[model samples]
Target: MRSRRAPLLIAAVVAALLTPAAAAAAAPAPAAQAVVASCSAAAWSGSAVYVGGNQVTHGGAAWRAKWWTQGETPGTTGPWGVWERTGTCDGGEPPIDPPGTEDFPVSQAQFNQFFPHRNSFYTYSGLVDALSAYPGFANSGSETIQKREAAAFLANVSHETGGLVHVVEQNTANYPHYCDTSQPYGCPAGHDQYYGKGPIQLSWNYNYKAAGDALGIDLLNNPRLVQTDSAIAWKTGLWYWNTQNGPGTMTAHAAIVNDRGFGETIRSINGSIECNGGNPAQVQSRIDTYLRFTSALGVDPGGNLRC
Candidate 1:
């Protein structure tokens, strides 16, 4: 009886282990979770085979295949299997045009023709960087809107710089008057270094500080950077154009995108000096440049061309 019992006990233990193994076999292995492959920089080619979840770039945009394919392009959807648009290779939508292409609008030759006697250094290339930094430069509105805004901005800049002739303010006598002793920073770049510089002739220590702060430069301490670096100089101009409303009205950016008219921009930039019977000749100069630019762009000059 004891021997029989011992055999039974041993058999019971073996049966327990065998039951678990049988249950495990019957349960079906846990299904493996499907994996989505990470996007890669591999370029798409019509000749190369691609599997589902593969990513590639074509025509400056990224795409992912939904299934296997060889001849189908990445950005198109058809019988070869659908390829979804992922994003740009740089992880965002590509600009409407390359940086230097549509940003400045007018070509170097057009700008040269506009201002033939202009200083060789005050170039379209010199302006691209500054214009790019200003969000209002090209992406402000439609192509027509953009062209008009650009024309408006360049018109003011033309007036300021004498059709891109002067980099620094021409009237040296007014230099020292720009510094404001009332400000707490107190003109770290000295009393006179903040004289108008760049396309809009950025003037005053406080203005220099503000523009430098926005642009991540230290114009307060090194105001001469506006005079020395063409890019920096133009940035100051764009800073003024995009940010400040001056002593008269709305931001030049707001003036154009809102369709408040070019004359409002004149009122915004220098209405204190040029608008409301202040200086008709100066206002006319800006309007003339704007009309010329619009004509070059082959667009209607619109109304309210004067302040």
Candidate 2:
């Protein structure tokens, strides 16, 4: 009973519905293209050595190294490294005030507020000698930058020392492990004395040797200088801060002034265990202290508060 023309009519309708123009109208539109940042700086090289304050480029962004580095790529090395982001190559350098410490960043009262029970042995003023000796310590960039750096530095120290109560590590079992026999210099100060000490609680035999070498002291031979000589002890901490990257991608100083944010400092200090895969509570403790210190100093906490 079907008409012969019915098949032809149906086929014509189907062909009209699936025509190229019809299909094009029915399909979803293509996504907009992403804008890429234009950068002109030379790329970073792993084989090349970079000293403190050296600049390099990676991933279209310019970065400055905090300390000596080789075989570590910027923006990738972490939890044991040094590199600070300056900006995109096209953005140019940020305005940096001439280095000066006309005003000490932290008042004694402010320092006391954070470290209410700080060890009497660790006098705050003694640190001035260490700071004076280091050209970049609290003296680089603007006054605001210096204050933020001071707050960020002490906040981490506060967490490390339990609000500045413990000068040396409480757990003695780990002391002996800090001496790495493989080091060419050897553990000159004996095996167990290389445990955490000073505000940064500098650990390991190599650290003592390197800090001593940088500061012109024999820390490897006389490790107790960190405990007995207050200025020297503080100097070790500052030396670690201003010069050594420790287990971080950037020096603590760079984390604040370089605009990588305070969180980067935490990553720079303890990111291996405290950041990403490690412990959030521990990381938060450091961040909480940083927020308090920054708040106290009347500076914006800045961005990236978490590791």
Candidate 3:
């Protein structure tokens, strides 16, 4: 996770891309050290990977492991727990493009051109790592599904935060605000509750609490923590993505594909009208963002725009 202050700076970068003068004026920021690790099955020994940093290592069987920065507990260790079974790596289905493949107006190069900064935050390798860590989406489909879905998620995030850099920054800010005024634990004064953070822009203390609770973190006290912690923010996003109650179930990508009214899905997640704000225009903007991404990917918009 990156800091919200970072996105304020990124806005300038985005502006630079829009104009030659801005680009000329822009100075690159210092790059952070990238984290890397290698692991092997033999490092595991024979014991399960604990939630903290403990693991079993025995003769011949070595399960190498690394820490997931975001969702760290005293006992949790790796992305995939040794006790858990991930079934087959391959589900045997040939990857197929979703129904409206022809509606997309942009080529992959054009998509890259539109969001060149995305490569800075999330590379293809990072997305593959995310998919690998999240077992629920591991068998989602073939490479096509992985690519398209990752692109869609990235597209939505790009629109929400202006780009991955912005997402990282805003997450650092922890998007303070209170969508639910009736609650006593609403956002503090002067904090822009609606600003939210991350690609989904999760706003409001309640949402923070809920997301934290789902991911087993104390986000209410440290909302900004999501910015510096990738695994935490990623897991929080995944929890929201997989949960069914809000904005429909986390599994409702097909509904989104059908172009169904997705503001309702967002509303379901937020449990408030703030998600829709009773404003058709704002809702439509979000819908358009999704459509534009799909269209860029050469997919149909699916006509479910009844927001």
Off by over 4 Å in 3: 1-114, 118-127, 132-134, 137-152, 168-195, 216-218, 247-277
Candidates' C-alpha lDDT: 0.77, 0.77, 0.47
Q: Give per-residue CA lDDT, model 2, range 133-167, as digits (tens).
A: 67676667887787788888888888988877788
Identify the runs in model 1 with alpha carbons over 4 angstroms from their true place: 1-99
**lDDT (10s digit) by residue, model 3, range 24-83:** 566676796532222232233112334423332222222223442222221222246332
Q: How do these models rank on lDDT, best leading?
A: 1, 2, 3
Scored against the true structure, residue 48 in model 3 reaches a CA lDDT of 33
Which ten residues in a row are the worst by lDDT in model 2? 93-102
Q: Alpha carbon lDDT of residue 159, candidate 1? A: 88
- The candidate 1 region of ten consecutive residues with least summed lDDT is 89-98
- lDDT of each residue in 61-112, candidate 1, tens digit only: 7777888887654433433546777555544542233355655567654565
